[model samples]
Target: MSTSSPMRTVLVANRGEIAVRIIRSCRELGLRTVAVYSDADAGAPHVRMADEAVRIGPAPARSSYLDVDALLGAAKASGADTVHPGYGLLSEDAGFAEAVGAAGLTFVGPSPEVIARMGDKVAARAVADGCGVPLPPGTGTLTAGQAAEAAAGIGFPLVVKASFGGGGRGMRVVGSPAELDEAMAAAGREAGAAFGRSEVHLERYLQRPRHVEVQVLGDGHGTVVHLGDRDCSVQRRHQKLIEEAPAPGLTPELRSALSEAAVTLARTVGYVGAGTVEFLVLPGTSEFFFLEMNTRLQVEHGVTELVTGLDLVALQLRIAAGEPLPFTQDEVRISGHAIQARIAAEDPWADFRPAPGTVSTLELPLGPGIRNDFGLAAGGAVAPEYDSMFGKVLAHGADRDSARRRLVAALGELRVEGVPTTAPYLRTVLSSASFTEARHDTGSLERDWTPDPADRPGAPSGTAETVETPTVSSGTIRRVRIATDRGPVEVAVLGRAPRSGASASPSRRPGRESAAPGASGPGGAGAPPIAPMDATVVAVRVEPGQEIAAGEVVAVLEAMKMEMEIRSEVAGRVAEVLAVPGGPIAAGSPLISLT
Candidate 1:
């Protein structure tokens, strides 16, 4: 590969906001862009933003985004010379990279061999060790017998993590030997569902470690540089909620060391394109350990872009085109501070359950230093078939405090009716002392954050309603009624019917209604374990005649990328199982009957 040839057209092998973001960059660079979408994204914003759009497959990722052959076919059909895989959904698949190159199209990422080496957690640890990078006490992929044998040395309170896949999927913490089996089993199931691999390994679990990561960029010409660091400490179940650039409160020496380590690891593997090298910083200590390397653009790359004043997507395209580094390490400078809050279609009050439906009205905040990356349009449907995140709000300012203040203000101004979001919760996080003081860790949300009832529908927090004023707005939502006398209306009521070109109402979907004559618990006494929210039953772990304990997991329901276990309400024989795996169920629907 050489920089002599020009990249004529780039096909974004992804969907949603990232795809639109890439297209915007390509457009600015005077390069043509193509978009690929599944059946669910036929009318998506990315499709309309591209020079050309192609429908690859059905709604599921396996059939579309993750289908390497299909993506290559799309590139060929659209005459695209390059493919940009926005984060997640097979972005780090080495096989996909190889196939794209074999099809005579650039993958816009690291080489296939490098991707494989870094994508595998077991192999990545070896790479880090060879490069003299600090690593945690961990083992490679282990069989059940090997895991049991190694558990003795690793000790208790270790984590079983899937060797493939990220986003906290397929990870479980075992506090003692008694919990190892169940943890391993659960991790395997989640890993298999997320990455099609169940292989897991053990690592010493650090208590409340800061999830800091360095952004690294490398050219094929052996130039690897760091773009500062980000603190993604605010999280729930391993999923990042808020991320900020420059990792506030890091000593100069420690920050330099972390950046140097990231660059060292990137250069070691001859990495190309944009990537993230994550580290776990011990609480109240300067010590840090290698966690994992994301071999593609990260979800929070926007915050980095805002702070560094660079177009990462543009840089990735140039790198894949075999261009040399445009600037030296010293030239890469960071200015101001930036923070990003992920807005997902989930109800924080209801255990963060998925809140999928049509967006009848969508109003994003607008102001200086505020950036909103989104995918949903007016009347757009938020389908349950994909990730729950629909958008992100990024704020930038001259300092950390200013950035935090701007982010909080932007969140308050954002309004997306018809489906509940994590907006209110994110606001609370930004205002919390832990976050404001930069003292939060990865476990901050789980330990200190709790959903407020006022954030939910029908629960107005600090508002005094007198007269409601109605006005029709353009786009998806036509009318918005605002309370005149208000001290901040916290809750958002459900929106009305679809405006136009929107999918059928989520309420009309089959099996979305509660089953009549709800089954009773043991001894014909209490109510059965009803579904907490609308979700698809992914698995059933119990049989009709099996005797179950009160807290035993009977079934697992998946919604908004989080798995909710349905436990037996009583200790008795399973009288009946009403839900089937892969079947859709509504809130209040019974999952099992015990007697």
Candidate 2:
């Protein structure tokens, strides 16, 4: 009888890696999936993987994913019965959920009312307090004079938070009255940019606290289950770079207390579907303070799944379809330690800004206990229009030490050749004594640490002075063009899925972008990887089979964008031709190979 019922079809109103992650889960549960993308993402990995894809609008996220009409239109056109707002953008938008539900399509998340309530940090804290859950010592936002009074009562170190904040965007720490106003202004501006409204709240700031969160799953039937906890203290600029489940230093009693607090909050609101309740753990002290609730799936949910042996995305599907909570409290247990590191298309040396351009080489580590939640592929483009994260490298181990060591080894072997990524930076942090000993806090990344030689990619002599954006013309096809420091480089992509090995055989197809030739000659300088910034190969002195000594200059390339030369770090004979002149290239494409 159940088989006769109509099948489930979900329209994913988002793009990038999360879209791919969600689609994979929907597939395992026998659901047909539709993907919606902006003009910029027509060739994105997510679009190609879906059964059907619809162009919602232009490149900007607000005009597309956050656009209610566009999302609804795509769902209707694709015959979608549900809309899965995969984290960020419209994920927590109550209005979007209401719109989808009004259109008679299920929203694969919690109720609209629940989203609204959880969004207000003030209200969320109130609920936690009411339910006997311990909370931070700060009340709702008060008048400016009241704020000063409250600050005094809460003590000097306190946090001013935007009522609607995520990604640590609208938070300011004030240590004294002199810094309070400035913190407020910065918090308000950032909050407005990220969440639109700038309403603010207050909380006492605990120095050196560890950021921890619990994953909660609930069904409308009143049964809610907790999927352990994740330690998310490894950060830079308040953005998490590494996360792990079954936190390293937590005692059994502490874990139970934290998990119960998360479960209690869900039951308080009759919450439905997947959500995370975050808290700030005072490391030395066993006590923790309630931070806020994320009413949507988090970016780090994979760690929880690895430790608990549950497919959260699949669980979301079952819950959205009105299924009961599959397991009881006793049944849900953390089996092992799991760790995840975000591999972003950004330069850690450059204040962690997004490094957007073509991806010449895209490869990931594969083995036992490894899981990759990725977005980019070879020949795909990384745009400044969205986040820099290309994927997350996750590994599970029987214990914390094994997980950390295995994770570090996997990261060392991982490579993304096109744009600069945080892979090398991740390795540095993982091997550090502080991290290895499990001593970490929210401020660890910002603390002074000697930069490893490997961590620093030498400053270019020069590159990318003037940027030229390349364009391709085709009637009726809207395109996204990027102006690189180099000359205009045209990239035409197939948004539709390739026949599995299309990229591997790109050489046969020809005309795709390739980097300038590598440098050669004295000083044992061999240009190993060609820099992507626009420049001319002013000089290519190395030939095939040339014996190169260490630190020799193999090539001298000029990027009128900026003029620069690359030297090989390895000592060997030239093995192959990696780049060609008069062609565009990106960072890390092999220019020369040495024996």
Candidate 3:
């Protein structure tokens, strides 16, 4: 094994909460930190917190965060000797890691060869099979025709997953053969857009499995140790929403097996720095299968830190600087329970649609056992160009129940205005009976849970506050906050109530004007189909005169890298299809006119 050179300065080649998180660790280690940002994040908290900041490019991720040349240039100009790809963007890109090494800068991760080998799911499966790690039955990368034939042999209820990349972006679950073609096409498109590679493969879909993962660290000196495990089954749309440490309700034997498997894989790959090996645990059985390994620090690494009392980022920095393992597996210990809830700018009632807006009011919870790692502040903007998640709220306690309750209390104390957030919805999940009993699996949230009616969109809760200010025009506009039996509700009195007798038109929500002259009311027949949020049109599946039934997808929109199907709310004949693929669209802009 080759030793890396000493590192004095590090450049965080990412943005948002992860950047801020890496910067914090660098500060503690007395290492200079440089932050790179796009035009959209000039005033972000990470930029201000870093020792120095650089402007890479425009707001689009392709132009800034994922641009390898831009990141290397920023590292060179900022006098950074090391580059830390924090969990997303080009974090797992083998090309980026190789580029950093070619530029004579240390990449704070495993070698490029390891990244490439493990990044491809098909190849990783072979590696696991060789190591005697359990793996699900799956096929290698396939073309469209080959995939169709393979699906028949593999049978129905299979998963189509991108060969490269993680984060649930290019994944689709098909229950029958009829859905295979469309699912494959959509998955390929998403994979191509997110990662440079679009190749995909098939795997047997597990039913109601628990998403569990083991956190492992290596020092490249033939030393690898597992830092316990995490349960991330509380998910929506296949993305994890809540995570807990020590993976509550795991038997000692199963936990030991998972750790041993993770350590074995890391040793086989000659892994270095922080990484996670994920697995799917079959409910009511001891069967578990390897999912994939993340080559960088995970988003839920903090949960491991809370339970193990180790600063994983600090360890990553030390390992990159050619330090040997300071402690062995026998010395590692786990204590206390920790739960992390992701706070994203999305509306749960609107199918978790991305809701981007300026932060008008920001109040994070503070107390014993509560930690908030936030990226935005009051007056900061949650831009539509990136991931909707801006922060995480974590709670630690003596045990699982205590930790869960503390997290629930912390979420209740949290407040974010100006944009819809997942806080209320997350609070509901944490308090649910399934969660309390540790009976919730990966599919429970989508299949068994629904948001409380009080937390629905436009429904007033006790915590709801006026988020927008009415603009003063020629006519008087009055804003009032009334205390209601449910909660406090805000109302805008437009134009002095129409002078007590003159015919008045129904007031519309601020900034939401009718898209067309003859458009019907919201969700009614003959209404023009409007964009639910700011996004890019990925495809238009409808044309003029095409008949569409309610709940039928008319188009697909890409926002924050997540694809959302734009479904018609009422049955109607399309009068005109206004959406063009690859075009930018704003919330409430008409996409299709229906008659």
Candidate 4:
């Protein structure tokens, strides 16, 4: 049975574009809105846009957005009657949702029991099986010993996944038995950090699967409808960078099956509110398996909204308010096409490293059938404590080709400065033949994509100029005064000592050079796997005297909300471990010396 209650105010328990998006919807509904922020976002735009705001905790997510007590306190203090967890952060956290309800505030999502049931990979798979939804060949949750035994039956080239993780965390593909232990270890660490769980399971790994998901909406009145399918095959390191609705080139039968399957699963779970049902499809085939269900609004939901001409957030609010189905399945109409590009604060050409800083300039694309969801304004600082995604640009048109053209043109008109972004890279992908022809798969990025070396930060061209610096002995800043037409100006200059021997540059800065060709033996003295970018060492997997094979992960570095594994380029013995977990590292700094 569903309960009906009116909500006067809503607290958006999230930070970033999603929060801004929710506030707009609440404003349209004539509802007051509250915003929560951490110390790092005290002055953020979301905080200023809401009817009321409160500081939850510190910069780290653990102390702020993920802190259930802090969020509950804010809601109570602000007298918010409802809570909207706008994707990521705590949106999918079942416990947090339960806490919000216990505090007498409605969570704009499914019940906590439903969330827990679908959020756990193991349980979700069982639910899918009972619902007759196809699933990938896999095992239930497993221990370390159980995983080994399961791997033997699953054979090589299997994926180990955290039973209670999402967004690609706690997942690893093991090609052989030798790599199983290391993969499990890395997956465990990432799983623990991402979801606070270390338990994992095994599954058969598909080499070239296309990721397709359906946007599902359900009201407590037993009405569930799918908003159609989205093709999210374009990704980097398992994180989606681009998404589109009505998955290109999908057969009508297949599309119907996908949608029907999603609705079936939602009805089986008695799902309520906004949710996403994801699937993995084998390229060039209609066979697809249930991947997982996200029990909240997705980041790419705007694309579906555009194609379907509906406000998902508004629907979520109505459902949570005990409203019945606004329309029947046959009444739902999906026309045209829509695409969304995730503009992240990172340099695509530089291993997609985080490039957080102040936004010196901002220019948004404006035209018919175009929308840019963002929280950034000129002079706003993009903090490093949160996800690197700063905005999303979406476009719609009467047809797929038209939509693609509009999206590409809009991306070209978009401009940003003071930090590198994936804008240019996204444009390239949109124009690539593989994408236009809909031939790309999940592994397309690793196999066929390469960043343009010339793509720089999103800054205006012809305005950048180089300045020469004088050699200095120390790394401290010195004050200097310059005369200007208006008045005298003061500037601070930091100095750096030249690298020894290699005065031109630090190409061979000690302990960084590769081994001489023809060298042989365990102590061959090869160049170590250096830090690809400045990041925090989240995990070190190797130790001195440990033997590792080529392609083995030696350490994991985290930057800009993404993780990169530093792997051995050649088989050798670990000679030294220079970095430890929680340590800061500079680009090109040796992490593990190999011999």
Candidate 5:
């Protein structure tokens, strides 16, 4: 267990950017690495970086990333002695941790009991209270009358939260008697959807609870230490957008207290490896309340690593090997500052709707302090089946001010084409006054922000052009060409654009061409068929050996929480079903080849 002894081979049990991160750390530590991938991630950056790789399952997380038996089988087959489950997916699943340990492979995290205790928000609160940590005023599970009475005791403006969810999924603020039931029901529904539980608890909601979290590392030898704090208040829809270490605007006394609280919580849990203990710091008071503990590495752990100059993954591997605490409390140091922006594949203008597609071109930022944890290359598809995050851009400097300025500048020059992304929107946030000075909270995004009209893509600055309309859909598409001063061009309304007064017109358009039964149609046998928008295939209804009728749905796709039926274009026997449910196939991936 000594630091001098080394590990030979380790398997990264997850995919995407974090897997690549662990692989790099293993390389630095003189350890061979294995990468696991789903069908959708076969060509990902992490797979290419690893020394070896094995396919876990199909694209869906249940079959792939969260498949514990397959992952253990792989470690046994590959002769891997250790397995590292990065954040999300199976990282916090206590059963998965126990399985890895039972298989005699080191699970690079806390013990299974610790994972279980922390994974359950209700029990975690009990432990924190037992350890003398301050919890916001709240009540246990109660019926309608009891909930109302408890809310009265906790005062108005309290939050109802599900006992099993984190990252603010099952939490809702209720301020009045009329809204308590509705709010509680909504919170419970969200909890049930997110964590498979409808049980919820209530707590007093702090209006300006600054999102502050302490990073800590522990080992089985009963040693724990704090590595400073990060500010994660910049958020939208309860998701963090920007994170920075050495949280801006912290006094010496508060910082010390936060660090001590984090270390105390770890000691209470007998924790190990890298974990984050988050707190909701009330803005104008010294009273901070426990939010929840993340039992695995965090998405923003990179900022902490940048400032502390420690490879956290290496420490995790070392601890799992039963090494004694590497350093004393005083040995940890906080230096400089680091800022990270989550580059999401969402449309900022459309309520941050997930926009997933292929990347035609990508010009990511590059410089001394700019770091990109990207998972995609040019032409890689960002399918709608998974999370809408492409990656994060991390920048560090001598201080907070320098780091902020550099991150803003770097994002300005970065470009991602093809799919709609928040790259332009993030640049605007970086340059805004509130973000520049770090003078904001989680609600500031909804408060002081506005969409920049100029960031939207449209026409060029100076151009003399005939705007050609798009002709789309393999069905009847109407297009007409109109002559202008510039030249002759087409303006076809690819598919049917919605019109007013019930149902307006049919395959007839204004500018270019129209299939008016006799008029000429666009090239392509018929009109080149287009998938109805973008969506993930949830079920394929047709099989190769079965026949489909004209109106029958060949596949079902889900997008924006709506199920879309993909109907057959031609009535014939299905020759092939090119895509499977839960697989991330492109828009044109043939669902059924009809004869």
Candidate 6:
């Protein structure tokens, strides 16, 4: 094993909760930490928690967090001997890792070669195949034409996956051959934007498969060990929302097989540091197929920590410092069950739309077996230019049921105002029978889950319903319902009074616009399509005089690194196009006019 100089100061190359988590671990190890932030995150909790901070660039990730030169510059200026990449951004970028090594700064992960090999879905498939590991039917990297040709052989109901990155950014599930082309295009665009590589591959879509992964740690000295398993089947749009350790309902033999396969794969590659070998398992069967390997720490690593009582981050630092494994596979012990719920700034009632705003109130649940890893605080901003997730709530217990109950209670106690959150929806999921029974799979959330009526904005009791009153010459008064522990109460809010004989204009907030008289807006006759949120217009699919049908996509908007297709609700002729590609547009802003 190659030896490196001892590290003292570490620079974190990411933002939000993961950054804060890494800094805390470093502090415990008596190491100084340097935090890098964009303009939007200057006041973020992670910045305050670090020993020192450096502003990298503007709010956009491409200009800041993902900028290699800026990150390395920060490391140099801060005199950090080590760089710890937290989860997303450029965490798994092989080029970034190589650059850090070239700059003589230790990267707290595996080798760049192993990262590049496993980060590519196609190449990892070959390694798995060589290791005699089971794999789903899929094709190698392909162009548009090759993808179409392979789609026919793979049949319908396949997934288009980005070859270079994970976290469900560059992935699309096509139900038929008709959707293959668009799926591939979208997946490629997203993959390119997120991972800096557009290469994609195809895989046969499984029916309600369980998403399971084995966590592996390796020392460059040829020692590798598996840290049990985790079930992340509860997902939406291929993104994991909930994760639990000691994946339930796995037969002993099947569990052994998964561990052996993962350890073998990691050892074969001479892997170092922490990594996860993901798999897709057919429910109620021993059959499993290799998914992709995340060459860095996972977002749900907290659950594994809760069960195994090990700090994966500290281990990564030790491995990077040329330390050997402190324990063998036999010495590792898994105890109890643990569950984690991701708290994101999204509106579950609106299909989990990203809802970024200032946090007016922040209250996290605190109690036994509950841990809250949060990045934002009261008065902090949730920037639209980054990922929506800002915090995670984890609960550990003696059993799965106990853990589930604790998480449910924790979420119930959680509160965040000013921005919509997924806490309520997550609570519902934890309390759902599908989850409690371990019957939910990767597709279950999209297939069977529905937003609780009480949780909707304008639902009946226990909801934040809006009641409009008669308009006066000044303006209109709206009563907003607020649910408290006592009961629901209506609070009258006064709007800005308009000028004499003038009508009120819509508020500039996203998704809160009031359609103007004879002006196009959502659900208005001859109204133009409006942007659903604050985003950059990626494409304007429609032009003036173009006839379109209801539900036809007129534009594509990119926000928080996710693409949203803006569809028209009423069929009409396009009168005007207000959105320009690559331009910023506010929520509720019209994208196109219809006549």
For each candidate, the alpha-carbon lDDT, in order, equals 0.79, 0.73, 0.82, 0.79, 0.72, 0.83
Model 1 C-alpha lDDT versus the unseen true structure:
0.79
State model 5's lDDT.
Answer: 0.72
Positional deviation of residue 508's Cα in model 6 after best superposition, in angstroms: 14
**Residue range 429-508, candidate 4, lDDT tens digits:** 89999998999998887679887545533322332121223446544332222121111212222332211111122121
Estimate TM-scores for all models. 0.87, 0.76, 0.90, 0.85, 0.78, 0.91
Task: Go through the candidates in order and give the C-alpha RMSD of each one to the true structure.
Answer: 7.4, 13.1, 6.4, 8.5, 9.9, 5.7
lDDT of 6 by residue, 1-595 (tens): 2233488999999999999999988988888899999999999988999999999999988999999999999999999999999888888999999999999999999999999999989999999999999998999999998988898999878999999989998999999878889988999989988888999999998888999999999997989999999999989878899999999999999999999999999998989999999999998899999998999999999999999999999888888888898998899999999999999987675577677777878899999999999999988988889888989999999999999999999999997877777898989999999889999889888889977656653343323234344555534543332221112222233342211122222221323312122222333354455665567888889989999987788888888888888777568899888888988876556677677
Question: How many residue pairs clash in each candidate at the backbone level?
Answer: 0, 21, 0, 0, 14, 2
Error of 4 at 358 (Å): 2.2
What is the TM-score of candidate 6?
0.91
Q: Model 6 — which ten-residue stretch has the worst lDDT? A: 482-491
Q: Model 5, range 238-319, lDDT digits (tens) per residue?
A: 6888899989887888888888888899998899889999988877567778888999999999999999988888888888
- TM-score for model 4? 0.85
With a 3 Å backbone cut-off (N, CA, C), the pairs that clash in candidate 3 are none
Candidate with top TM-score is 6
**Which regions of candidate 6 deviate over 4 angstroms?**
1-5, 457-523
- Per-residue lDDT over 1-595 for candidate 2, one digit per residue giving the tens place of the 0 to 100 score: 1243344798998788899999998887778999998988889889999999999988766788778999999999999998889887888888889999999999989999999899888988889999998887887865456677778788878888888757776687898988887677657756665667677877888889899999998997989888888999998757789999977788888888999999999989989999999999988778998988999899999999898888888888788887787688889777879999998876565345355667877778888899888887888877655666778999999988888888998887786666667877888888888888889888888774434434554332333321122335321111111122222121222222112112211111112222112222111133243333333354455889888765566555432112334555557788875556544444324456666
Residue-level lDDT of model 1, residues 6-41, one tens digit each, is: 798999998988999999998888889999999999
Please tell me which model should have the higher TM-score, number 3 or number 4.
3
* Candidate 2 lDDT score relative to the true structure: 0.73
The numbered model that scores best in lDDT is: 6
TM-score of candidate 3 relative to the true fold: 0.90
